[model samples]
Target: MSRARSVRSPRPLLGAATVVAAVATAGSLFLSLGLGLTPCRLCWYQRILMYPLVVVVGVAAIEERSGVARTVLPLSVFGLALAAYHSWLQVTQTTCSVGVVSCATVQYRLFGLLTIPNLSLLAFLLVTGIVAVASWRTRR
Candidate 1:
């Protein structure tokens, strides 16, 4: 007698979100390193949060572990908050002080509208939403 494999993996949504988070993290790195753009204080804070998320969620999703949500939840929420604040600072034009790196600097703009912070904020929001929904669905 042979043991059978399961029909499908159960955590597709989580897996996808984790992959997207990884992609987002890579994109941020590309913007900073490849494009020669420097990150400000808030950007550094956000990067600190986002970088780990890629690894934590990626491993959890690959293992189909239930504890993934518990680990990711607080990170996602805090990341979202940081992204939002960064975006707000960018929008308000009150980013840099006398000796600080300008958080409001729009290093690059796509279509003259989207900036670095904007992109970061958007990515965080999407990831957070996906994680929240996926966690809620899985718990049911």
Candidate 2:
């Protein structure tokens, strides 16, 4: 009697999460470079939080480790919070009040709708949600 081998790979959720993170990061990079939209201090902080996520998730996916996924989730969540705050500052006419770079003067908004911080907020939300879903799925 011959035994059948299992052909399934591990951590499908993690793989999907990593792909989303990579795509989000690359898309943001494209928007920044191609559109000549420079990032402010807050935007840079968001990028700092996001750029590593792509790497963390990518490595976790490769290794199929849920521990890394769990660890990285907090980073994305924090990024979301920061991006949201920055976006709010831009759209609401609030002063930066602290940073070396003033978020109030970036002037990247389009039709009073889309701003750099707004884009960052959206990206943060997307990445956080995707990673959170993947984390939940893998918790089983």
Candidate 3:
């Protein structure tokens, strides 16, 4: 009896995801630089989590390492959590009274309703979801 062998590679999904992340990161950086909008401390923290994802996902895509998926997914999840909280604080207009930085003073609403932190939150969720889905589809 002969056994069937798989013919597909997982590199495409990883590569695509990486590209998406990198583009989004670049866009965010451009928005910060091109526009005069300064990032708050929490925004910086979220960036710390997001920037690495571009490299990690790119490398993993090229290498096609199973272990990379496992590791990267968790990091993305952490980023998602941070971004979500930051968004919530901004949208709610709640003050970070205890912290050195004030969330309330950060100008939560942008373009009338969309907040800067809200953008970060959405990006985090999208990136994390993509990574999770791609990782799950990856071959062992």
Model 1 per-residue lDDT at 5: 23
| Stretches of candidate 1 exceeding 4 Å from the true structure | 1-10, 98-100
- Report the CA-based lDDT of candidate 3 relative to the real structure: 0.70
Best-to-worst lDDT order: 1, 3, 2
Candidate 3 clash pair list: none
TM-score per candidate, in order?
0.84, 0.73, 0.77
> Which regions of candidate 3 deviate over 4 angstroms?
1-8, 97-101, 105-113
lDDT of each: 0.75, 0.70, 0.70
Candidate 3 positional error at 7, Å: 6.4
TM-score-sorted candidate list, best first: 1, 3, 2
Every model's Cα RMSD, please?
A: 3.5, 4.2, 3.9
**Residues 1-140, model 1: lDDT tens digits:** 22222223326766777777888788888987899888888888878878888888777777866457778778777878888877787788865762357987767886899887777777778767776676666556
In model 1, state the lDDT of residue 107: 79
Return the TM-score for candidate 1, rounded to 2 decimals.
0.84
- Tens digit per residue, CA lDDT, model 2, 20-121: 667767866876797866666877787788888877877877876667746786888888899778777766775775565577755555576787676667
RMSD of 3: 3.9
Backbone clash tally (model 3): 0
